[model samples]
Target: MKTVEVQNLIEIGLDGAEVEVSDPQGTGDHFAATVVWSGFEDMSLIQQHQAVYKTLGDYLTREIHALQLKTSAK
Candidate 1:
């Protein structure tokens, strides 16, 4: 899971969300991302994470070994 690929997936799934992803451990499988989208405003912290997870779909635990997500509203 390259950073750009992850960013693209999130952006597309979240309806053009702004995402910044980094490979913290220099391993493509371990990533950290910060996402900003208007949809997050009414969602709780857990819900926010779930929304991102939904975007990633099956890639969450499979392709992406770990994702540290920080989500915020635009």
Candidate 2:
């Protein structure tokens, strides 16, 4: 639930992704992240978001309450 933990999970899941995460309200459950990876190339916006969500997996459903996500292809 910590910001670094979230960042680590995303980085691991997305392989060489560059991930930046922050807790905007200083609350552990709420997060904002920007993920950049070459694998996102050719994917639609929705698909890009889905990939990030999939990386978070069950944490998105349980530990994390909100995620303001932004993604881009490197």
Candidate 3:
């Protein structure tokens, strides 16, 4: 999930942002994603995170187990 999410972030984030998604559990059951993006240019920090969260959708609601998000813009 981390790898896939990272790839998704990179795809959407373009060269504008640096992204990191981690799962300390090593079981892929629980996860945390930290994203830094310049694509946030005109958007507020919260909005930027909202964009990322929109991507994950039902995955977290159902099959993802547990997930947390930290997002920023630079």
Candidate 4:
């Protein structure tokens, strides 16, 4: 998927989230996302990643072959 589509999916799933998606090798299936959301304030690193994964759902395993996620509290 395109980075813009990934960004939109994340933004829709996480209210007030800031999402940045990139293709590391110019391969659309491999992506890296930087997600910032206030909801992560009290969550663990794992939880933060889980939230992102949950939002992306099947896209992560189906459309996206690999994802490098950087998550933070905003």
Candidate 5:
């Protein structure tokens, strides 16, 4: 995926939060994203993970094959 797309995915996923995604796989299907956000402060780990997956929409059902996520609160 293009850099902008990755950026947008982060933006949308994190609710316009600032984040950077790394695609070590060099494939759009698999990606590692570092999400830094204040909104995550009091959220549960499952909630945090859900937030990211939520942004992917139907991608989880069909589209992207896999995603390895790394999240943090900033």
Candidate 6:
């Protein structure tokens, strides 16, 4: 998937989240995303990552081969 599509998906899924997605290796399957959202305030690191994973759903392993995620509470 393209970076814009990834960013849009995350932004929509996380509501008011600020999302930035990039293809670091210029490979369509590998992506890096940074997401900032208030929902992560009290969540653990694993939970934070899980939230992103959940947002992507089936698209995770299928369309996206690998995702490097950075998440923070705003």
Best by lDDT: 2
lDDT by candidate, in order shown: 0.92, 0.95, 0.67, 0.92, 0.72, 0.94
Per-candidate total of colliding backbone pairs? 0, 0, 0, 0, 0, 0
- Candidate 5 C-alpha lDDT tens digits along 1-74: 54456658668767757677666777766666777777878989888878878877886667567767766687
Candidate 1 C-alpha lDDT tens digits along 27-66: 8899999999999999999999999999889898788999
- What's the residue-level lDDT of 51 in candidate 2? 92
For residues 2-70, what per-residue lDDT tens digits would candidate 2 score against the true structure?
Answer: 999999999999999999999999989999999999999999999999999998999998999999999
Candidate 3 clashes between residue pairs 3 or more apart in a chain or in different chains: none
Tens-digit per-residue lDDT, 1-74, candidate 6: 89998998888889999999999999898999999999999999999999999889999979999999999999
TM-score of 1: 0.94
Candidate with more favorable, higher TM-score: 4 or 5: 4
Question: What TM-score would each prediction reach against the true structure?
Answer: 0.94, 0.96, 0.64, 0.95, 0.77, 0.96
Clashing pairs for model 6 are none
| lDDT per residue (tens digit) for residues 10-48 in model 3 | 547456556676777886768777777767778876787
Model 5 segments more than 4 A misplaced: none
Off by over 4 Å in 1: none
Worst 10 residues of 3 by lDDT: 6-15
Q: Tell me, what's the RMSD of every candidate?
A: 0.8, 0.6, 2.8, 0.7, 1.9, 0.6
Task: List the lowest-lDDT window of 10 residues for candidate 6.
Answer: 4-13
The local lDDT score (0 to 100) that residue 46 gets in candidate 6 is 97
Residue 29 deviation, candidate 2, in Å?
A: 0.6
Clashes of 4: 0
lDDT tens digits, residue span 16-53, model 4: 99899999888899999999999999999999999988
